[model samples]
Target: MANFSTNEFKAGLKIMLDGEPCNILENEYVKPGKGQAFNRVKIRKLISGKVLEKTFKSGDTFEGADVLDTTLAYLYNDGEFWHFMNNETFEQIAADAKAVGENVKWLVENDDCTITLWNGNPISVTPPNFVELEITETDPGLKGDTAGTGGKPATLTTGAVVRVPLFVQIGEVIKVDTRTGDYVSRVQK
Candidate 1:
């Protein structure tokens, strides 16, 4: 564990409070003209998903959790558990669905992802920021809809639906931004 002053607080930083794990959701450095400076932070409990607000003096120090990240390849799911293999050692680790959560939609077999480990256990899984997938189904472009202002809903191979320009047709590959689940552009291939 490392000590960090309140001034070092930032979003996504894991810290230990009262012997429990919490993640910083938001942090603001607040000071009223002549008053003492402090950090107002909104934190969420990692295990319980509960959120709470706390304030700390600028000079106060808190114990930062020792979180580590490692690149891992996502393997096939085993019904209840999502399995991943460490890129370096090829060791497999299984984590509950909740740990992977919505990221499961962006995961493709053998895809590489960053897995955050807390105390050697999988805490969170982050998928690639962008992915290329083929459009499985969508309405054919309408006649004389040359302006291309309107878009049609298309389903990807992974079963996630996204709106793509009318020109997009079935079996066409397109790039998607997983962060927002939006279409980036059509893939040439």
Candidate 2:
């Protein structure tokens, strides 16, 4: 168990607090003209996804959390839990909806995903920033109409619906940004 001082607090730092692992989302130092300095930290709980703010003295220390992220191949979803497999060891890991969060819409079979493990258990799952998905359903595109100033809604193969350019067709594969659920570009070939 390593200790982290207030000066070491930064975004993406994981530390143990109140017997749970929490990720530091934001850390800001505040010094008053008359009083002592403190660090304001915004942290999100690992397991439950709850977020809170805590203040620590300038010299306060916190234990480092045993958090690690590993790349895993996504297998499939069982309606209740999403399953992922480690390619090297053939070990499978299951994560519930909470852990998957909005990333579930970006998962396709065989896609590589980053799984955050805390104390040997998966605490979060992050899909690739960009995903290529084939459009399963969408309105037909008009002839000689290639501009996408006015896009149409499209349902992807993964059951996630997103707006695509008017030139996009149901059979065409397009790249989508998972973070914002926006269409990036059409996949060539």
Whole-model lDDT values for every prediction = 0.84, 0.90
Tens-place lDDT digits, model 1, residues 9-85: 88888898887678899998899999999888999876556899999887898899877778889898889998999
Clash count for candidate 1 is 0
Local distance difference test, candidate 2: 0.90
Which pairs clash in the backbone of model 1? none
Q: Considering every candidate listed, which one attains the maximal TM-score?
A: 2
Q: Which residues of candidate 1, in runs, are more than 4 Å off?
A: 10-12, 18-20, 23-27, 32-36, 42-53, 143-147
Worst 10 residues of 2 by lDDT: 141-150
Clashes of each: 0, 0
> In model 1, what lDDT does residue 17 have?
88
